[model samples]
Target: MQRVKAVICYDGTHFSGWQVQPGKRTVQQEMERALTRIHKGEHTPVVSSGRTDSSVHALGQVIHFDTTLAVPEDRWPKALNQLLAPDVQVMETSFVDSSFHARFDAVEKTYRYRVHLTKERDIFRRHYVYFYPYPVRVEDMKQAAPYLTGTHDFSSFCSSRTDVTDMVRTVHEITVEEDGDELHFTFRGSGFLYNMVRIMAGTLLEVGKGLRRPEDMPAVVEAKNRESAGNTAPGHALYLVEVRYE
Candidate 1:
């Protein structure tokens, strides 16, 4: 058997999420169905680097699957794209070592949350960006973001329903930038808990609105309570930007 790694990108507007669910349409379900059809009667499961929540898009999501058939790596992308939906496309494919596991081998993940801060939202970009009519002070958001960079117990930023026991994770970087009327929040971390990025974005938005002091980040983090943090931003604004492996 040979292991093949596929890089995928999806719009995520029509699917429930990335994982396969029993009665719901999903990215993994579509990919697995396509693989089953390509392999004729054989069925293969595609393992993704991570699970993205509903309405969250991906730009460089990676997955790996083992197959018995010997197909040229270069043809994988074209063949899969032909079978996959227009919103989901296989960007690239390569032969990987048999021992390489997509989820286990992943070392880092980056996500970007986009917000359009203006009186009127752009009709063309409405599906991708969250529209907030209030004025956002980008400098205030940047000043508050550095406190979240580094290893910390992020229970306050995570969803209350998250079952993960360990809340400590390393945030390599957190950047807030403005492009015209759009505000971008980019976070690079070793791993993330459920709703962590969205909550962080919401907290940063509070700081930008002068509702939260920049110096309060440490205290808020130490609180380790979800209620101490701001509301979770919409999942549609979040994108799985990239995944890195060693």
Candidate 2:
């Protein structure tokens, strides 16, 4: 069997997320179905670097699968694109070592969350950005971002339902920037807990709005209580920007 790695991009507006559910339509389900057809009814399982939540999009989600078919590596992108829906596309593909597991071998991942701070929301970008009418100080958000970097127990920002025992993870970087009425929060990390990024964004938004002090990040993290953090931001505004591997 040969292993194949593919770069995928998708607009997550209509699907139930990246993973397959019992009856829900999902990105993984669609890709697996397309692969089954391409492999002539052979069931092939595609493993993703991470499973994005419902309504969260992706620009460069990586996935891998093993197959016995002899299709050229260069043909995988075009072939898969032909079978996938317009919203989901296969950007590129390559043959990789059999030991390269998409999830296990991933070294880092980056995600960006966008917020539209305006009185009136843009109809075109409503599906991709979270709209907040309240005023936000982008500089304040930037000032608080550095506190999130480095290894820490992110239990306060993680969803309560997360089953992972260790809440510690290294955040390589956290950047906050603004362009016109759009605010972007980019986070690069070794790994993330369930709803961790969304919670962090929400907490930062509070700081930007002057509702929370920038110095409170340390207290929030040290509390290790989910209630210490702010509400979870909408998943629509979050995008899995990229995944890195060594």
The best candidate by TM-score is 2
TM-score of 2: 0.98
Over 84-159, each residue of candidate 2 has an lDDT whose tens digit, in order, gives: 9898999999999999999999999999999999999799998999999998888888889998888998999899
Best by lDDT: 2
* Candidate 2 error regions (>4 Å): none
Off by over 4 Å in 1: none
Q: How do the predictions measure up, each by TM-score?
A: 0.97, 0.98
Clashes per model (N, Cα, C within 3 A): 0, 0
Clashing residue pairs, backbone N/CA/C < 3 A, model 1: none
Instruction: Residues 196-238, candidate 1: write the lDDT tens digits.
Output: 9999999999999889988999899999999999989988889
